[model samples]
Target: MTHTTASTTAFAPITRAACIGGGVIGGGWIARFLLAGIDVKVFDPHPDAQRIVGEVLANAERAYGLLTSVPLPPRGRLTFCATLEEAVRDAEWVQESVPERLDLKQRVLGEIDATCPAQALIGSSTSGLLPSELQTTLTHPERLFVAHPYNPVYLLPLVEIVGGRATAPATIARAKAVLDAIGMKGVVIAREIEAFVGDRLLEALWREALWLIKDDICDVETLDDVIRYSFGLRWAQMGLFQTYRIAGGEAGMRHFLAQFGPCLQWPWTKLTDVVDLDDALVEKIGAQSDEQAAGLSIRELERIRDENLVGILQALKTGHGDRGWGAGKLLGDFEARLAAQVAPAPALDITAPLELVETRVSPAWVDYNGHMTEHRYLQVFGDTTDALLRLIGVDIAYVQAGHSYYTVETHLRHLDEGKLGEELRSTCQIIAVDDKRLHVFYRLFAGPERREIATAEQMMLHVDTKAGRASPSPEPVMARLRPIALAHARLEPPAGAGGIPARRKETAAA
Candidate 1:
């Protein structure tokens, strides 16, 4: 069971990627690459390929919008190529997601290996076919390997990397590294196998479930309910072995195994056998599944599934205090990566406001009135405040040292409405400052005109967190803050700095 752990810390990101198919999995790969800011070239023979990919991309965009507050990278160019050669020619990575037939896969790999850059790594999205078989027709087969991903590949992050006999070790390493850069967990299986790891487990369970249906023990809906309500929840977070370890209780794995070892010998599962999937069984399963769906379209059901996954992943993110747990930890790490991509704070421009944050309004930020909601305005202003803090050296390390600026008061005025998908930028102005107190004003501008949509005057206090009292900020923080404050002192006071007109307040209520 040799493997590469999903703890790849350092690697170069793929600059360009190519997808050989534009179906569900291929589109997912394209969405992932594009969302990570890598341009993609795609070749799919389907007549409606663009529309299909567009729908998947739309769902992915919606899911990602609700998934995290970390500002995503700007989407890269999506090009639909007329031929596979054109798609793969300059790509740094090429993904083959054609139908799972071995002959088709070999033909595609041959074409890709012949056309793509020699260094390009090719990942086949084969659920079970051995990569060794898929690579047979390629001259440079070293780059071809099984990189199986779960369905709705945009959301679920696991990619099982199974290398063929001809595949180079470097290919496996580089593949995992690339997957990590895109916020996916890729584990390299040391030895190539028939179905790989994830699907093998799924097939075993699926087989038993089918037998139960064939024997009239339970229907498809009941089986799904049993899983979703029970171990499905545990498996999402802790996985199999770890959950069983807890069942061991005081003694752990050794005791738990001793208690349940006898159960393994019993005929509880039909793993070595499978029920015939005849027409009657198919009809029964299909009928039950239709009932379970309750007439929801595939797209509608997919949205529901994606929303549930996002909620679960987010919960995992905050599970262990603020650090995160399981895949949630990976998400937190990915978000940290995204946050790093924020342009570094520039030198303070004291004569005018410092533009602190630039972003687009997320679809979720809008209200039923079709404008950005009330609290989201504060979130943007708060982001500007955070940026200003970083500029002044009040970063995570500084706060962990027992002192931070705590906002004490705020005055906000919304001058214009914000709409979904509107481009936004926020600027910060230093109104006043001292060793222990800082006052700043923020202006939020929307669209190309940079019209002011909102403004907030905030008073913040530097505090010794451990001592529970006001404290002077460290000298490093003050060093950066002093110059900006000194330069801003020469400017005329802002017109509405401390005062709000009654008419303006009345307008806000309206």
Candidate 2:
């Protein structure tokens, strides 16, 4: 596999990005760029640009909130430039998302070429426009190319990177590096091609869809459902070729080809078919679509689409079943990193107690019981413990390298209930420590009031990930944990909370 790494010596910090339009695609480009922590400057003639951009940002924020594994970094500063020149002046990358007009694209490219630095990379979010056509009038055509992304750019992972004949390999590499840094998947096209890969496939599917609707074989809604229920699921994990490979069975590609080759000669579709946008067909499709989504507004539909996309993509990353197209490779990379840092058992230190506290509960944390569930409380506390351990230098990489700690046993007492949106804190202290085991006590408290909410005592063991068994803590790590545990042991334990609720004699008697 060819891998591209960011050049540490010549890396240019992409702090600012410039967008030439503020329409749907432009706005989405701005959101993704900014949400990935790049400052954005946008220029558009429309008077409603500000309001429209604001709405796009709001939607991007909502979609980002659903991602739990990796947190979205802080949003970059957004600015509305009075002129195109001003927007591109200091930008490392400039994205053109204007209307699909060759003249307009040429004009914009010319203006950008005259203003922006020659070294700066320029990308166009055009679905089918060739880079040659778009950069025809540019003096530095090599710097400009197509970076076609799907609608809702913030959620979609694919970005087709197509370069014209004059396009430099270094520029393509640089663009791919930036996109990869922001968690986007970039596929490089060796030479300029019309429609690119995704668009060509989409065009073919769209042609068939139009034919289906026009012939009255299926309505717009039904055609969409056919894709969503069938090919969409298959496409999510594997593309057509790999999916067909599996269907081919043990016979492999040759056998599969022989079986399906006959279908190629069949009149499956009209290669030169075109559907005129007549009033009757338009009304039929529009009415049916409106009826299918009766009560949903545009925003509601967008939310639904984004939610489903996120769920599918996240599921693919988890490698749940039938390893997805490229998700397995990415997940493998992530898991390798995780394995290198996680310890098999928990290790204790006396000098510094684990930073534990009752966590502030969000609306998403509340269960039907109205109080924080037992599992959630453990989750919050566990996260808090992990954070503290990380601060003390025992991180995922540390644990995965066979030099970390794990919880062997846990004892808890629920003294009070926590309501949604309530502020909570947790306190942890190391009570005992040895070469293999570390015992600690944790107290969860309501913030400010310091009222005890829950108490937990846990025994942690030192573990070696490679051996998959308990082991002695490494000498360096042990030295660090010992001092911290000693210091924590000297501090007075908080008053009020007692043993586990079930073990309380009075409660049991009552």
Candidate 3:
């Protein structure tokens, strides 16, 4: 495995990163770093190292495109170093994803410690290795920590951060801060243990799953169907404790335990029993797995997995409070950070169409025709209306006060297509405003060329929620809207401003 390294150059301090292996986990680490705009130096002697990492990176890029609307920073350079020493030379953060062998890991860490800068942090990507054992050979063991990430690292946000006895508290804190910057939720393990947290739970369930298969109680497909079709979905969002708490219904967890706790004592599982992976069992599992995959290649299955994860994540991004649920909440925080980094929306530029919303056409917004679906166009335009209302102080608190703007009518005109992942922005120009009625026109633009995609003409009425009827805006609210409306009135009006869009200007897009 040969790799094509980008030209060598100075990298931003902490963002200068390195990976010592290029197999699945290593490649995933590489993808996550590069996508986070961190330069990565990967050293892997495997002849197909480049091919493997490239495939993973391709999938990661696709997943990211579907995952969020916030624009990502430019990709960092990938350098395939000739040696481990060369890879870690300038890396402030080094991740070792070599195969899980004690002697090999010790040798590699010994080599990395001797040559890498003293300030550099070393992370072991071992799923089951004790961080303490890995740190045995390191001269500066304080910097050696465990950073265990799930497969398809770019999509999944959790990374278990474990510090060995020799590892410094500051190292764990620094590692977590770095992980947070790269969009990972760094969960600190209280103690250094083998197969920390996530994998241990997964192993228990996996053991049961294998027993079910080996005992002929269910086929691989049936077992998968049972999981992916039911509790698996529940597990993704609410997770174990919360799901059980919900299962308890109105009585809650104490009641749930009273009802189902006794099942724990039943002869329910072979939790302590180890199943033999003898030839017959191995062949049986392999054949069943092959059938379960149909004709899809490993790469194909990875894509399917990514798509499902992205869909679940996107759904969760819309969950819990103003953020999301579980990993989805982490995702929401990440995007929120991305939004924060951008220059704050310049003081409501009424001089131009008020650029209110910027987003990308996510996968869910696409249709079979390979364009953004019609309703999504309306969704974007509605978002623009909401933004306008908020700018005039019709915020959540304001709405909670029994007052808000309600859209009475809307006229949308589709002018062009919005393909999946296309960059999108909306500009709103107020057309007219009175004590009770406000009319606005919005144009949706796609991509850097600022090509027009669609337009929306809308009228909204301020109402008293308690009275449930149109009402004059409070003076404070009108004070803000009136200034923008007056300024926009001075500008030339949009084409066919006051009426229905002409038939020729319409299309199936919006």
Candidate 4:
């Protein structure tokens, strides 16, 4: 565990992380950090720790790759440490996810607190344990706080940040920034409470579920159906209170509370009653749960769950108004941040079409006809435009500085159909550029043969986004664009690039 290595010496800003306890949560932290291009050092004595980390990383890789269109940072290194000291040796952030035993957590936290630099923050993955208890044995308790991330921590964005009695305000702020950098939404609990917030609601629902099953009111499968098919959809975006507020209709929350307030005293629920967990009850629940899953392995079930969550979340991101709002807005903001972080293209060969975006058709893009849907082609073109802008020095900062290109007109030609899993690459050829307008063409190709699948011709106008009107682009951006445009003019213009295709020959003949 104490072996020295050369790679440990090159830690940069937010570049390295330490995960102690390589169980589900710990391994998930590793995946999140590693995928964010932060090197991760993991410590766990369990024999299967490496295998667990690998499996979790694989799941995370697949899920995150499909989660966003923004380019991600390069994958970081992952190292397994045999002992806790080595794990903490150079990590800027240390996450302790040991079992919930207070004494054990304290022992581990104390060791981390002693070994890690004072500037290095330590976060506990305790579900309900107070930070007061966790820091009791630590020398630098102010730097330790509760950072409760949801299950499958790599995919879920919520992280409840609870600072204890001895926790410093600065420590909480630092924790929030770190969580945000890793693409997580961190909610800082203003006050410490058992079970935090999310878990408390979840525990209540779980208690009710247990009672339901115990009383034979419904089986596990039915319970799941009632949830996922019912309020579960609402809960994802609007959550409980907001959903109920809408239920109030014209009267709003006041009327809703008045109408349903009396239900609080009704004995319709058995939350106060304790269910006895006899062997027979346990066996019955286990068999029913197994029956619900059929014969699918845990990994298979996890993959399905991750895919469904990703699809729902992505849909939520594109929706607003009546559907509701919450994490989706946050996700959109994160995408913007990711877009901003992308480095400009190293160099461009303007003599040819600028290769900007190379991505495969996502499974979500497949339609009932088993081909890439029509709208997705537009989405890919949009991504290609974003990359084109990035290549010519029009980055997030430039856009935020009160000028950006807005696509004003688009004409797409579907030369050939694209199927699911087909690798699609979009290359941009600048047709013309002026201070206020950009005329561009993009060619979409499929697979290694690079067969032309589609082409998009668009006219983009420089706009003051705040004013919602066209404006001249800045001189610096214009300077970069003009040179690239001049260079691209030398190449032959793409055939059928700028015009919508006329009605097919058969339709005309008919």
Per-model root-mean-square deviation over C-alphas: 6.3, 7.0, 7.4, 7.1
Q: In model 3, what are the clashing residue pairs, if there are any? A: 1-46, 1-47, 1-48
> Which residue pairs in candidate 4 collide?
none
Give one digit per residue, the lDDT tens place, for model 1 in 234-326: 999999999999999989999999999999999988988969999999999999999989999999998899889999999999999989999
Rate residue 36 of model 1 by lDDT. 81
**TM-score-best of 1 and 3:** 1
Worst 10 residues of 2 by lDDT: 1-10
lDDT of each: 0.83, 0.71, 0.82, 0.82
For each candidate, what TM-score against the reference?
0.88, 0.79, 0.74, 0.80
Q: After superposition, how far is residue 194 of candidate 2 from its true place, in Å?
A: 1.8
Highest TM-score: give the candidate number. Answer: 1
Residues 41-94 of candidate 4: C-alpha lDDT, one tens digit per residue: 999999999999998887887687567766666668999988899999888899
Candidate closest to the true structure, highest lDDT:
1
Q: Is candidate 1 or candidate 2 better by TM-score?
A: 1
lDDT for residue 140 in candidate 1, whole number 0-100: 95
Candidate 2 C-alpha lDDT tens digits along 282-322: 99888988989987998789878877876776677667564
Candidate 2, TM-score vs. the true structure?
0.79
